[model samples]
Target: MTTYTLNQENLNAISERVSTPKYNRTQLTTGIVHIGIGGFHRAHEAFYTDQLLHDTSITNWAICGVALLPHDTKIYQTLKAQDGLYTLMVKEFDGSLSKRVIGAITELLFAPEDPSKVIEKIASPEVKIVTLTITEGGYNYNEATGAFDDKNPSILYDIAHPTQPKTVFGYLTQALKLRQQKGLKGITIQSCDNIQGNGDMTKQMLLSYVKLADPALIPWIEQRVAFPNSMVDRITPATTAADIEQLKTEEGIVDAWPVVCEPFKQWVIEDQFSNGRPLWEVVGAQFVKDVEPYEKMKLSLLNAGHSVLGILGALVGYTTIDEAVNDKNIHAFLEHYLKQEVVPTLSDLENVDLEAYIASLLQRFGNVSIKDQIDRICSESSAKFPIFILPTVKANLKLSRQTELAAFVVAAWAIYSLGTNEKDEHLNIKDALKDTLHKQAELASQNHPEYFLEIESVFGNLKTSKPFVDAYVKAYKTITKEGVIIAVQNINLSQINSI
Candidate 1:
């Protein structure tokens, strides 16, 4: 039982074990510098770029993956050891698996180890596209104010020490300053996170950061950088010990850091690059003039839909997303929310079969192999709701459409923030506003929905809306009284009766 390590030497040996990359690795040159290298980036962006490198003409579009955290040192070491090659297993809806060796990342850099090297790479004229997946909170944005929070301690630290910065905005500002000083061309900054208008938001945050840190570089940055909005989708779960062992036992390959995801992957990008970009369109990426509709559709429908499943699933003692979606009531609740509440917020798009999209999401959510956890989806609820759920709530309110389901989703979050499930199991609360949320949750436990809703940072003035208040109060009382499962079943019954 010989175990083959995932590296260039073992590529040929493990041909039967996994899908080894066919392109020549040695000839690949770094054209893109990707920040916040994580499981999603490896599965989505790097996966697409890896496919593009198959064409000999596009050999220069290889990625130099950089992890900016001290916690990323292990991943940085693992990726470096394997020459930036790792396994990507795509779990299909039919329980089928497609395993491939992603070789798009030719270099790996740990910013904590060598900040100068990382800055130099991003500042290089050869690197035309700088991408990020630094999560929602990483932007240092105050969602309530719709602006970058300059007072954030991290931003403050980065502002004070520009050269040795900690956050992504600081690095970008410093890198752009270097480019300006060197008379180098500007580069595109693409954000592949789940945030809405990711590119526009990044641009706003970066410009604001520059203005506060170094005002002189603001105009240069304004002229040079292009933050194109994008919608990236894939259900890549956190790699576990079981996944690692399964790869070795089943595939006979030992990968230190492998990304596991669903078979479906999509990247809808606005075709606006400052200097130049990889021919991503050649690899199934949609390059369009406007990414707003697509972004809204995905965020409001898929992302917000996940939160609904997560909070509800967590409450009913469901562990995985598959387990949650498999429940008839939870599944119906998701579909109802999507069709009744979420879809009406957007106008029709060209060639976009949203029905098909919802069906695909249903299948994706029910894929047992991926085992997407409710806790994982529920992790960033505080930051996520403002981006994903609140928009639809706002839209539906203006249209005067039924907001019962939307209000339920937010109420489900309020209930979940109590940090315990129906079984009295201790739940993990991962949010920037954890203290405030807990305080509000304690107050809300006494049947005061206003305690949670009045967190103007998240709900805004929506707390004052009588319709939303009525719906949220009813849902909150129902769940607390009848239990999570019964409340879901009751909602479905009511919907059926109304029809």
Candidate 2:
């Protein structure tokens, strides 16, 4: 029988580390307000915060987690059930593991439950840095224009009644307004999303929304807020019952909420904070003058490679990336795609060896125990494509010749939009452009094969380039006639070299 409920003993047993030696929980205060409290935050930022708490200098940096959607309430309930204590398991491919109980989060607030409470927390003077892990779609930017969509009801509502309807931007604007009113020191806004120039992106969206709402707050935000771009990497799969049972049996403790992540972790920050930040460099974070090259390397190589594997894995009926990577054709496809197409386009990667990086990525994808799902990776492709594939495509296209391997990725994305697996089973696609894609696919099936390219938001700028258009059309034709596996097999280094 289980011997513990919401007691500190149970928490200590589950974490495998005693809290008394690490953190003075009573002394902790809400200094950092995390906007999107998802699984990634629980595993990554919160994990770092937990480590920083041990130093006592930053015990006050305890996280105040906020959830914007209804679905997140469940996470809130689970965390609250465990007295804000949960286990984070880092599993390696070789079976070595580490587990820790994270207690960095001091409180959880659901926007829907109490919007005022959320705004009040963000407006508080104690909150120093506001971090976000809201997935690509959460930003509410229009893919076509690369700008904020004022037409979005959420944005419109937030703008119409700033204090009444709270969004990440709304909360930020209100908090800044409060800071302005009180003449308090400004805070840094750190974006932990995978988007390139994430800090700039967040600043743009916030300012755009603010300009529409109140023009007066613009200069105030300009002088006070500092948006720092960052590159964050961690492979954390969705938790399952099997994971729960394994932990229960292995550790003799049951945690309603536990985070499982791959052994690999990275956090690269731009080192531009307004009100100061923790000495996270001591805890393995890289603080650099320029994160652009690193950001490009990570987004283009690691993220783009992940997307390629994910789409192909789903189409081939493979559940996890490990299974997909094990297939000879898939493995060869990735190797060729990265080496012949993706690698050649990236310039000035510091001391990074592209070959070694690709090998490491392959190893991570082949970790069968991690079980990173293709569908999970495939979600929010619209937001991911611009960062992951577009730059490579543009770079390859600018060369004297066009690269078919890069074109194949675009073609594969079009094929993926058809919404069926290799077995012809319907696939559940999650994207901001889902409705438009369905209609576009229907039109293509009827007679307008070129309609897919007409998605100006996605392919609009590329459509003007004849070489890219020709490559895309040719690859799309091949995919339609021969299927993905054969198409991928036929692609070679010579084809990319020709471009």
Candidate 3:
């Protein structure tokens, strides 16, 4: 019944069983200040930075994670207790596992506890790169207008009390003000989210927020900060209790917060860091001239593919992504979706093979070892669908491309939002717009088939398009009449017939 607590001291002990940091943790310095540190950041960017620190003599690029929101308290305490040390367990598709203690995160700041400290850290001269992985919903921007929502309570609060800010924009504004006062060099604000033109989006929102909060700092922010667009990929699931137990039983390392992800990881950056960046390219990251194509490709293939499986998979009684992709009908529908609806929307990709990317996505989705929850992919999809799958639907319709599969995906989401499957069983839904969308879906599924599309914020006048309406209505009716499995099978058969 002996177990070792994961910390700086136990690293040497755990090194015998699993990988440990090869760098001296004491000499690490803060060069990158990351906001919204979550499972994705740990599994993706932190993993990459950890490799750089171990393989090279680089110690300045260490990350100081900002625990901003209230929910980040536990992670802050966990990491702080461990002296910013935690294990990263990579589960390969072939059923092999690799565990390593990530030492790249040398410092942790609970922004809620001390807002000024967080602002001071960002203003630090040594830190040149600030990154974010706050998910799709965290950007606090108007989806339809692509502008920052200054009306947000936290944002408003941060506007009034810049030194005691709550939101990311507020914190950035305050920190950048400090930098301007001291005449420090500019920094890069890289967004590692899944949004297309994420850098541009972040820049727009930040500038807009700056205009509202303090118009004077707007010019300084414009000149000082570099928002680099990036494409980050890895199927890192929220660490479950089972994962914690497995690590304890197998590796004998009891980490308070351990991150688990698939062996596959990729990061493509727009080479626009104002100050400087880590030599991440040496450790498998790409610094390209333009990240738009790569961003669109990842959003189209990997993100949308997850949804196609995640939403449909939920309706089909599959709890996990692999379970859904493994189903014969679901797999067929997904493959058709990738090559048919999603591919045509993608163009101008440089040296990137669409077919091979599609194949890799298919394989990645079926990574049973990762066990990425359908709920995880299905969560906050009101924010996700706008970026991930709907564009495919719009593009396909515009080009007269096949939207049968696209329609199926939307129809699947509509039904999935209802909190029940074909069996009328309770399904897990984690959407902020769940109550609203559920009511709309219920009404649409019952009488007014076009009613769900009435949510213009989401469907956005798709109800006005006759072709989309026809396909969506037909697919909606089909799924309700026959189950999800039969509905997808019918669409597949019809698609194959048309060709």
User: Considering every candidate listed, which one attains the maximal lDDT?
Assistant: 1
Quantify all predictions' global Cα lDDT against the true fold: 0.88, 0.79, 0.86
Q: How many clashing pairs per prediction, in order?
A: 0, 2, 0
Residue 493: error of model 2 in Å?
A: 7.3
lDDT of 2: 0.79
Worst 10 residues of 3 by lDDT: 141-150
| Global CA lDDT computed for model 1 | 0.88
Predicted candidate 2 versus true structure: per-residue lDDT over 404-479, tens digit per residue = 6667777777777889876797878988888887677666655455677678777657767777767777877887
lDDT of 3 by residue, 1-499 (tens): 4689998888888888888898998998899999988889988899899999989998899999989899889999999999888889888888988888888899999998998998888888999988998888888976656667777888888878877888888888888889998889998999988999889988988888888878998887888789988899988888999989999999788997899898888999988989988999989999999888888889988998898899888887788899999898889888888887788788888788899988888888888898888888899988888899888887888878767677777877888888987667788889878888899988987767778878776777788888888888888888888989988888788768776
Candidate 3, TM-score vs. the true structure?
0.98
What range of 10 consecutive residues in model 2 has the weakest lDDT sum?
12-21
Worst 10 residues of 1 by lDDT: 51-60
Model 3 alpha-carbon drift over 4 Å, by segment: none
TM values, all candidates: 0.98, 0.94, 0.98
